[model samples]
Target chain A: MRAATASVAAEVEDLRRRYGAREALAGVSFRVARGEIFGLLGPNGSGKTTLFKILATLLPATGGRVRLLGLDPAREARAIRRRLGVVFQHPGLDPKLTVLENLRHHGHLFGMRGRALAGRALALLGGLGLDDRAHERVETLSGGLARRVELAKALLPRPELLVLDEPSTGLDPGARRGFVAHLDRLRREDGVTVLLTTHLLEEAERCDRVGILDQGRLVALDTPGALKERVGGDVVVVHARDPEALRAGMRNKLGREPALVDGLLRLEHPRAPELVREVMEAFEDEVIAVSFGKPTIEDVFIRLTGRRLREGGPA
Target chain B: MMGLVLPVTTLWWREVVRFGRQRSRVVGAVAQPLVFWLLLGGGLSASFRPPGAPPGTGYLEYFYPGIIALVLLFTAIFATIATVEDRRTGFLQGVLVAPVGPWGIVLGQALGGTTLAVLQGGLFLLLAPALGLAVSPASVAAVLGVMVLVAFGLTGLGLAIAWRMDSTQGFHAIMNLILFPMWLLSGAFFPASGLPAWLEWAMRVNPMTYGVAALRHTLYLEVPVAAGAVPPLGPSLAVMGAFAVLAYLAAVRAAGRKAS
Candidate 1:
């Protein structure tokens, strides 16, 4: 039964959600395999939040079908809620409650009690490296530490699927790494399927599979490596004094125009080294700087959406 | 049934714990009403005597039950205000996603508010002797029971409003526009008799009037016959009970809705 159910932990088929006339999720569809970390990557207003709320059973979709753990969210939301753990982007812990109290509250919400509940709460705290701070109120804890408590509370019920929204939003680099390591361990040992939505490219890159969303549509869905590979070669960027003039010159000489994004000349070429050298030498006076490197997830997003992942890129 | 009970009790416990942690709220909800009672009841006692009371009845004594009702009202408002903050802090989101139904969640919150209101009101009841009013154990128990029912209804009314409010400012607007008027016209501040027809009618229709009347009737449990304008104990209790149920259902319905 585990293997059979493990085939698909969550599935969305042509899921569409709208707010009146405005479409938030336009026919978005994807399947999350059990034990895999699947991420929905998008920029602001890209509808990832709308999708997250729908999956969390907080918002009803205007149209389409969503199934979590083989149960429809519309009809069997309570059943889905029982097996699903959610970590919201904002702080969900009650500032007045201690870390242990928050975990205990979460346990009781799921009908766990007595020594069983107490044992589960303590075990989760210990596992999350929060044993020493369990008695401290969440208001007194640091941002990263509070986030860990939130995760521990979510895990109190031992959910089969853990859904997080921008899980590493406020964490520093070290804390972010620690949080990711915990997720990795959970996936490996407990076979828990993790679903998250994020705008950070690095965060998305670490996921097992990522679905890129732009303006309410999923543009590209694949492993980070595969998405980057789709760009197929080095990414060459040219910051010239006159990008239009240089583009014209490059078009005449190289017989191709580089994609102009955020006022920079960008090109994905199989042999970018020769291309960069030739462009620099050919337009030495016009070119200020030339750079080329392997494609990153940001480049993949740019290649697909024709926009920078982060709005308002540097000139 | 056990599954539903856990979430309700857990939510209820959180409400009480949160209220206990905020000492300022205790002073605001309990002490503030006491000051209101002392100032208003004292100021009015020398100038006017309540109509239709026994020969020696003063404004202070007439207003005592009203003050208890005010304590319950104030505590309910303070407790339900947390619902707005819960939404802001994303705590409500966590509860919404839990496996429990809206009925359990709202019941927990309503009961939590009711507990705080009753505790504060009961604390105020301790001052009853200082005012030269004597009460038996039976009257005291009846007063507490009346307080619980009244607080539950008031808290439910507050929840029905707070759940749909996006900001505390909006809630304050509602408190001023609706809640304050409800309290004032409920015969808590003054006697309902000898008023304009419309004002008298407002008090007659206001559900909280029955709550205050019930407190008065139960507080004077020793009185062989009721004074003027105090509704019968049985009918007042019935109204309070019906109001509690309807208000609680409204709160549950509000919880089940998508926030606009």
Candidate 2:
């Protein structure tokens, strides 16, 4: 038995990337433990992909040190890549090649050929439930199937560290679920350390530990429950007939005030239901409805950084 | 060693499989040179003759060797654009993140592009007889050897340029600016016999000039010794070898920077 490698799977320290006037990654530092599902959560332009690219040895940092399994990414990139598997956000499969051929080609890159290559490729396809579509051209597959193919390609070498950058972007709901489930299996069965980046809060919650990246800084890093708990106070959202007036009434009654932005009154209070009932009783005619719940990752994000995860999108 | 071979071979095979799927690219690769041979060679044949030309020889024969050089040039240059596309599409990232070193990517691409160039160059030989040019078995083999060297040299140069270019638009613009000057200055389309002293000097220094001269020497069964032409197959091959080494180094460096 090859003794289980105890070294860190990935480590980035004081990493910074500058694109002319803009800083893509600014002093970003993080470490992913061996065999952990680490999630890099951030919205667009928050430097999630940039950080992942640096860890994958695909991009250089302006000033930082990156080590993958004790190998320097800059000087020992090839050796690091041998033990690392990366699934890019975009579909990187060759469009002309079939799914199985894509995996075979990827396997060949790692030095596997002939029956060994073919057997592993087929087994991966079967494991991914893509056996029937093995012969189909990658261009002919749907977005979700193509993403699955990308995953299968990444797993062909059985790499110790699997890096996925927004692996579920174009995937439908079912496909996303299946993909996550498959990744979970990879973590559980194969003991592969997964480093993934995503903008989806729910997906980030599924990770063993989530790192919240906002504007090139890791604002929060912990398990989902711990992060939500840190925010404190259950989230009390008041949907009133006149949000401004109700917000004023609640502010006047509670004397503690709440965050009022874009017609939603959000308050973090220990007795959120009591506060909601007190506000509703005080403004019986003005209040329309009250919804109370424990703070979710989204609320945590909103509280930490005065914006929702999908702020501009359809709520 | 197996680690190196495995990734390089994989990337090379992927490129070949991709080339096989694009029918139009194949046609463009083989057809463009033949068209240049027929149209430009025929048009020049009527009015233009070799300075100390032999009687009864058509313009196609004189232009045939140049067309082979052109074929190699076009294939190699277009392959550079494919590299740019691969980079833009993130496929290059996947390749870079593989176990193979940066040099492996450069070598694999150069080898794959050179193979395609050779395949296209071979088709030109089959079309030679139809153009009233005779190709003996020896000449065919020698021409193929020159084609390999020229293709490898040009592929290295293309990979170097593609690695330097940040965007496809920038790559295409640079290609347009360099392609015509390099082609015309190399004397691929015309003889350098009557060119200005400076222009002839440029041709003498141009790598493509050596490639064209060597290829023409084998294809036309004539000693390549123009006024400013670098004589002997040895010197020309040396220039190409130098280019291959320099371009390969640049490619490896650029790939390393990008991968870093």
Candidate 3:
């Protein structure tokens, strides 16, 4: 079991890509183990898309090295593509073709044919719960259903590695969950390795490992539980009038400064409940509400980069 | 090799299937050229007599082969517009990552466009007898052969242009600014013999002019015309064949380069 899990499915060492004066990926590095579901999490303009394009072989890296299935992407891209399946952030299905037609065409591109191709496509549709609508045009299907067809098409060649760019972009919560579950099933049943990029924290949480990117740099890389523990304690958010005054008063009294964010005093402590109670009682006039909970992936991001996971509004 | 042939056939099949689904494209491809033939041919028949002609040929008969060439040009340009659409909708992204090279993708599109152009041009040939032109088996076969050559070259040119354009509007503007004028000056609307020296020289040098001249030569193979009237068949075919190969190479080169 140890030997089986130690094999690397994909690797990137100090990979970099630049567009004119702007650096999209700056010396990023990571390795995905066989059958692992690795996720790259970052908000818009964070270079995750640029990195995804390079891995897909649609774009070339300006510096460093990348290996897919132990094959160099710059030199052996065709060989790597033979063993890799890709799903883009936008829909790749031909809207005019039926779901089965789309899958069959993809199989043909991989040199698949006749009974074997048809059976593989139908079986994948059945697995994805889309067999009943196989004959329907892709344009007639819902976004979630079309996404399932795209997944079925990619799996037709039985690829060793599957790369998806922002796989859950437009999917609803339920659909996203269903999509992730399908990836899990592929990993368990076929031993296919998955590398997906997304800005959704919940989506990253479901992966075996997550790489958090911020402005072309990876800020953190670890299992969700391990990364969350970096905060070391519960997160406490204190809502009050004149948050700066309350923050100053708390610093003078408690000898620890709480971060002022969006008109709230936030802090991390081992004894969050006791601290919340003390703050409520001492500054009862200034305090509006005090809430505390175990640190989440969002808190982990906030701790590493003094900014929220999303800006302007919630993800 | 399976690596090259399979993707080309599949991509080609996709273009044909998509063209079938969009009924408007079918009607527009056939109808637009038919309208041009009728309006222009009818208005000019009385005053126009192609230079060095057999004396009694009307403009309707004179412009018949030119209209067929126009049909091919239209079909090829419209068919290759899918490249821009495929890029815009992210469909081409999927194909680009496949094991196939850019040659496979461009060839598939060029062949798909050729098939559509030949199919439509053949249908237009049915109207030849109406203009007192003979419809013989030899002429029909030869005309289709010429149609395939001309269509393939035109489609490759279209793909070469379409692959570099980010928007369909830009493609339209380029086609208008470049291709439409080339078609008008390709000896399609007027005989090259009677034009001003410079304009006639332009017609002689235009690759599309050779394609139109070849179609005219093939359409009248059964009933021969004057020597040096339409361009010689051997040189016309050679020019068209070279254009097809060059244009296809250009398209593959465009697709091979990274967009960044």
**Could you say which candidate leads in lDDT?**
1
Sort every candidate by lDDT, greatest first. 1, 3, 2
Q: Candidate 2, which segments miss by more than 4 Å at Cα?
A: A1-7, A19-22, A239-249, A271-273, A281-291, B222-230
Each candidate's number of clashing pairs is 0, 1, 0
Evaluated at residue B109, the lDDT of candidate 1 is 94
- Indicate the residue-level lDDT of B26 in model 3: 97
lDDT of 2 by residue, A160-196 (tens): 9999999899888888889999999999999999999
> What is the lDDT for B173 in model 2?
65
Please give the ranking of all candidate structures by TM-score, highest first, separated by commas: 1, 3, 2
* lDDT at residue A110 of model 1 (Cα atoms): 90
Tens-digit lDDT track of model 1 for B1-260: 77788899999999999999998997799778889888998898888777767768888888888888888888888866889989878998888888988889999999999888888888989998997778899999999999999999999999988887777878777888888888898877888888999999989889999999899888888983434476777998999999999999998889888421
What local lDDT does model 2 show for residue B9? 76
- Rank by DockQ, highest first: 3, 2, 1
Q: What is the lDDT of residue A219 in candidate 3?
A: 90
* Every candidate's TM-score, chain A alone: 0.96, 0.93, 0.95
Comparing 1 and 3 on lDDT, the stronger one: 1
lDDT tens per residue, model 1, A1-315? 667655898988899998889999999999999999999999899999999998888888887888899888878888899999999999999999999899889889998899999898888889888889989999999999999999998888999999999999999988988898899999999999999999887788889999999999999999999999999699999998989988998899878779888888999889998888888778889988888899988899999988898878542
Residue A165's lDDT in candidate 3: 93
lDDT of 3 by residue, A30-50 (tens): 999999999998878889999
Model 1 collision count? 0
